[model samples]
Target: MLKFVLKRLLHMIPLLLGVSLLTFLLMSLAPGDYFTTLLQNPQISPDTVARLKAQFHLDQPWYVQYFYWFKSVLHGDFGYSMAYKIPATSLIFARLWNTFLLSFVAMIMAWAVAVPLGIWAAVKKDSWIDRACSLIAFVGLSVPDVLLSLLALWFAAATRWFPVGGAQSPYYDLLTPMQQFWDRVHYLILPALVLAASSLAGIMRQMRSNLLDTLRAEYVTAARARGLGEGWVIWKHALRNAINPLLTIFGYSLASLLSGAFIVENIMAWPGLGRLTMEAFFAKDSYLVVDSVVMATALLVMGNFIADLLLAWSDPRIRLK
Candidate 1:
């Protein structure tokens, strides 16, 4: 297992290099840059733009510029964000925690709710509970995330059940620590629910299908024939095997949340990496854009790697090759 993990870690070096290089090339080839916006301003002289370009090594060959950027990356410097007038690291990291927090909570909420609901639906089969779960899942799959977020925002406005937008209440600063924590939680609930809704549906359906199939298997029949309680047979024997495939989805879901959160966060007004990435893209902040892409790709790769490890652990038949 250690050897397998080490091998996977080693492979990530080339994968990450390719990802970073591709992002760098794509950004370089893009028509406008961070300076392009400044160029459009009437007051900013061309000479000033030239000076800024030189200062940031933007005039250098793309390949040369990449190496310079790469060097800074090695030293934990993700280059300066001209648009925000800050280091890319600082800007990204500040927002990264919020993104991570939101994604993590949303993921937990999704799995916690979906898994049990799926099991119940499968166990109940054609019962009313199963039908209800199916209807909810259908709604989840059908509704686009942007629309869901907008609707959630509207609901919040109407019911005052949640903050309409943003990561905190206006009274957060004056609140006690516990109050502050709850305030953040209150703000988080809407966006997290919005983020989790679609994924929860997909996961629940997948779980239901897998569990149903597993329950019909010969092993499950054998377990039943051994006079085991239905609960024991399903939970102990069937569920373990049924959940193996879900590990793969669990891995990819980590990265998908980043992209999905971009839309949800924007609509919900949650300050997170998604919004920052979008802002950086439109501003053509090359360093910031590259950093964001690289970070996302890294998360994706890590998620897959973790999934592979979990799958192997869950199913001994899937030994690392």
Candidate 2:
């Protein structure tokens, strides 16, 4: 396992470098950069603009600029955010937790709800309960995230039941620890629900299908023939095998939630990496954009790596590979 993990980590280095290179090249193709608007300011002379470009290596060829940026990255420097006037790493770190919090909450909610409901649906196959779950999953899968976010905002507005947006109330610090926790939860509900709803459908459907298939397997029949209780046969034997695939899904879902959170965060004012990335892109903060992209890609790669590890652990057959 240690060898496998080390190999995956080693593989991540080249993957991140390639992603960063592609992002840098794409950003360069855009007409202007962070300093382009500065040139329009009559108060800022051409020399000042030129000097700024030189300072950031923006005046160099794309490959040369990438070389310097890559060199900085190797040394654990993610480069400066021209727009925020801070280290790109610091800016990303500040928002990274917020994004992680939202995604984590949503992921937990999704799995908790999805797994049981899916199992039940498969167990009760063709019953009204199963039909109801299917209907809910259909609606969840059918609705667009943006529309759901807008509806959630509208509901929050009309009922005053939830905060329409933001991660916390302005006076969050003034509250006691317990109060702060609930305050965060309260602020988290709308966006988290929005994010979770998007994922719950697919997971539930996959679970239902996997369980159904597992239930029909010859081993399940053999377990039943061995006089195992129906509950034990289904829950212990079938469920164990059925759930293995979802573990793989669990890994990818984190990165997907992070990516999906971008639109939701912007729409709902969640104040996360997605919003920061959007702001950076609009400002043409090259280094910041590159860093954000690299960060997200790393999450994706790591998520899959974790998934592979989980897959190997859950099913010993995979470890041999």
Candidate 1 wrong stretches, greater than 4 Å? 169-175
- In model 2, the clashing pairs are none
lDDT per residue for candidate 2 within 1-321, as digits (tens), equals: 778778888999889889999998999999988988988999999999999999999999888989999899889898999988988988888787798888889988998999999999999999998999999999999998899999999999999999878889999989999999999999998999999999999999999999999999999999999999999999888999998999888887877788789989999999888998999999999999989888888877877887787788888788723
Instruction: Tell me the tens digit of each residue's lDDT in model 1 across 212-265.
Output: 999999999999999999999999999999999899898878877878898998
Q: What is the TM-score of each candidate against the true structure?
A: 0.94, 0.96
Give model 2's TM-score versus the native structure.
0.96
In candidate 2, clashing pairs total: 0
Each candidate structure's count of clashing pairs: 0, 0
Clashing pairs in 1: none
- Which candidate number has the best TM-score? 2
lDDT, candidate 1, at 303: 76
lDDT of 1 at 61: 73
